[model samples]
Target: MGPLQIKNILQTSPENQSVTVKGWVRTKRESKNAIFIALNDGSTIHNIQAVAEPGQFSAELLSTVTTGSCLKITGQLVESQGSGQAVEVKIDDILVYGTADPESFPLQPKKHSLEFLREIAHLRPRTNTFSAILRIRHALAFAVHQYFNDGGFFYLHTPVITASDAEGAGEMFRVTTLDLNKLPRTEEGAINFKEDFFGREANLTVSGQLEGELGAMALSKIYTFGPTFRAENSNTTRHLAEFWMIEPEMAFFELEDNMNLAEDFVKKVITYALIHCKDDLNFLQNRLAEEDKNKPQNERSIPLLEKLSFVVDNPFERLTYTEAIEILLKSKPHKEKKFQYPVGWGIDLSSEHERYLVEKHFKKPVILTNYPKEIKSFYMKLDEDGKTVRAMDVLFPGIGEIIGGSQREEDYDKLLGRVKEVGIDPENLWWYLETRKFGTAPHSGFGLGFERLVLFVTGMSNIRDVIPFPRYPKSAEF
Candidate 1:
C-alpha cells in the first residue's frame, strides 16, 4: 500500500488492518508495560498515537525514538482506548530513520514563545503551531488560484526585475553587477548605470499591477501572485522588505465592479479556508485565545473564528473617504483627543483611523473610497472636481487596510499630466502610458499582501511569523 498520511490514517475507521506510518515523533511516554508515542507527519494539526509493548523493540531503538525523531512504525489499526483520539496504531515493528537529540532539540514538547521559534525557523515547522499555520497558508494560496480560475481569470506571471517603478514609491532594491570598488562614472560625475547588467538601470519590482494591467487590457481578466521587494529600512511587525503580492486587474471594470470583485474575492477565499482548513483554524483559534488571556480585556481581540465568520457573513460597509473622515471626526476618540494623529480631509489615514472605522464604528469590514489625489498614487483615476481619486481601501477589523486599489486612468493626456505632476519620468513609463493611448479601456485593480492575509487568517500578530522566511531590515537568516 502507498504511504498513508497521518491525517488520513487518523480519519480511517479502525478495521484492524495492517498499516505503516512514517513521521516524526512529537512526544513519547513510557510505562512499565506500555509506551505511547504521538506521531505527526505535517499532514494535519492532530497527531496519531502509536503504542508499543515493552521489549517489543530494542532498547537502543526506543531510546532513539524521542521527541523530534523520525520513525516508521508498522502496526495494526485499532479503536483507540485513549481519551483524546479515536484511533491508535498497535505497533508490531519500529524503524528509526533519524534521531534528534533531546537536549539539542529546541522544541521539547512545551509552550514556546513566537519570538524564540523565529530564531530556529528551520525547525519551527515541526511545532504544532507553525505546522498548523503552514497548512492554513497553503489552503489560502490554493484557494487564491482556484477562485480566479473558476471565475475565468488567467494567472499571469509578472517580472521580478523591471526598469520602471510601479508604485513610484522610490523604495526599490537596485539590481546591478557593476564593480563597487572600481566605479563607472558618466560625464556629469554620476554613477553610470549604462555599464550595469541591464545597460540602463533596473531594480526589483514593487508591484505587478502595472504588468497585470497590461495583461488585463488584452485578456479581460488577469491576476499576478508573486514576490515584490521594497528597500525601506522598516523594523516593524507590519512591514517586510520582501513580501508576496496578489494583484488582479480587469478590463472594462469600473470602481464599483472592482469593489464588488474584491469583496467577493476575499470572502470566497476566507470561506474556502473555513471549509478546507477547519482543523488548523480551530487550533489557531484556540492558540489565539490562550495568547490573549494575559492581555487586558479591552486589548484582547475577538475570537479568530468569530472574526472570520463575521467578515464572510456580513456585507462590508462601504463609504467614501470623506464619509469615513466625517465619522472619525465625530468619533468619541477624536472628541476625547485620544487619536494619536490628527485627522482631517486630504490627509492619509493611519492604522488607528482605519481600525476605528472597522472595529469601532462599523464593527465590520469597511471599504473606503474616493481618497484625495495628493495622498494616493499618480496612476489612480482623477475625479471630476480635480481633487480626489477613485481609490478604495478594504479595511479589516485587525488589519488596517487589507487591500488597496483604484480605477486606472484611461485618459492619455490626463494620465501623462498626473505622471509629470508626481515627478515620475514620463519617458520611463512610456510603455504603460502607451496602453492608455492605444486600447486602454476602463480598468481597476488592487494589491493584497499575501503575508498580511496569512497573518489575519492564522491570527498571527507579527507579519514575520506568518511567512516562513521573513525578509526584513538587517535580517535575512534562514
Candidate 2:
C-alpha cells in the first residue's frame, strides 16, 4: 500500500493500525530509552511525532536523522502523550532516504529572519513560516477559479508575446533573436527589426486586457490569469519584474456594472480564505502580533483576522476622482505640508494619496472613478465632459490600488483619435480598431495584481514574501 500523508494520519483513528509514512525530519531529540522525531510532509504546518525505542534501529542509521533529513517509517499510529499534538507514531522500522548535515545546513531549528531566508529561496519552503504562507497562497488561487466559475465566467488564455503594448507605457522586455555581433541595419542606419524573429518588434506582454477584450466580444464574458512582465527597474517592496495578473472582460457592461463585479469578486475570495485557511492564518496572525510588539504603539495595525472580517462584511465606499481630490486638498496632511506630491485636479494620484484615502479618510476600501483622460489609458471610454474618462481604481487599506479597470470606448472615431493623441500609430492596432468598427458592445474590465491580493490576505508586508520565487530588478537566482 502507498504511504499516507501526515495530515490524514493525524485526523484518522489509526491507533494500533500499521501504516507507512514518508517525509522530511524537522527535529530529533534523544531521550533516556527512546528517540523522538518531528516529521513533516508539507501537508500541514503541524508535525507528527515519531518515537523509536532504543536498539530498534542501528546507531549509525539513527545518527543521520538530523534536521531536514528525508525518511520512510513503518509504524503503528497511537495517541500522543505530548502536550501540543493529538497523535503520534510508534516506529517499528526506518529507512534513511537522504541525510542533511547539521553543521552545513542553513535552516536550523530556531527562528530565522525573512530577509535571511530570501537569500536561500530554494530551501526557504521547508521553514514553518514559508510553509504556512505557501499553503495559504494555494488556497487563495483555488478560490479565484472557484469564484469566477460560479459567476459563469470563461477562462481565456492570452498570448504572452505580442506586437502591441496594452498599457502604452512602452516599458516592455524585448524578445529578439538577432545577434548583436553582426546586426542588420536599414539604409537610415537604424537597427532592422524586420530581420528579427517576428519580422518586427515583439515583446513580453505588459497586460492581457486587449486580447481578453477580443474574447469577451464573442464569448460575452471571459477572464485571463497568467504571467506578465515589465521592464521597469524598480527595487522597492511593492515592485516585481515578473508577476501574475487576473483580468476579466465582459461585453454589454457599463462602468457601474464593472465596479459591482469587482467588489463582489474580491469579497468572495477573501471569505473563502477565512473559512479554509484558519490555522495558517492564525499562525501568521500571531507572527505579526509578535513583530508588532517592538513597533511604536501608533504604528501597530489591528489584528489580522479582524481586519479581514471587516473587509468581508462592510461595503466599499465609492466616489468620483474629483471628489477625492477635493477631500485631499482640505485634509490635515495637505494643510500641514505633509504630502510630497501636490494634490490637484488633473495630476495623477500617488501611492501616499491612495493609502491616505483608504487608511485614514475612509478607513475602508474605496473605489475612485472618472479620472482625467490625459492621466489614463487611451482606450478608456471618454466622459461626456470631454476632460475625464470612465476609469476606476480600487484601493485597499494596507495595499493601494489593488485593481484598475475602465469601460472601453466603443466609437471607432473617438478611439482612433485617442490612440493618435497618445502618440501610438492607429495602423499598428488595426485588429483592436477593427473590433470597434464591426460590432463592438459597451464592455468593461479590470486587472487585479494576483500577488497584491495574496499579500493583503496573508497580512504580509512585503510582496516578495507571498510569491514562491520572486523576480526583481537585479535578482533572478534559482
By lDDT, the best candidate is 1
What overall lDDT, based on C-alpha atoms, would model 2 receive against the true structure?
0.92
Residue ranges of candidate 1 with Cα displaced over 4 Å: none
Prediction 2 TM-score vs. true: 0.98
Judging by TM-score against the true structure, name the best candidate. 1
lDDT tens digits by residue: candidate 1, 1-478? 6698999999899999999999999999999989999999999999999999988888878889999999999999999987999999999999899999998989998999999998999999999899998998999999999999999999999999999998889999989899999889999999999889889999999999988989999999999999999999998899999999999999999999999999999999999999999999999899889889999999898999999998999999999999999999999999999999999998899999999998889888999999999999999999998999999999998889999999999999999999999999999998899999897699999999999999999888999999889899888989
Give all candidates' CA lDDT scores: 0.94, 0.92
lDDT of 1: 0.94
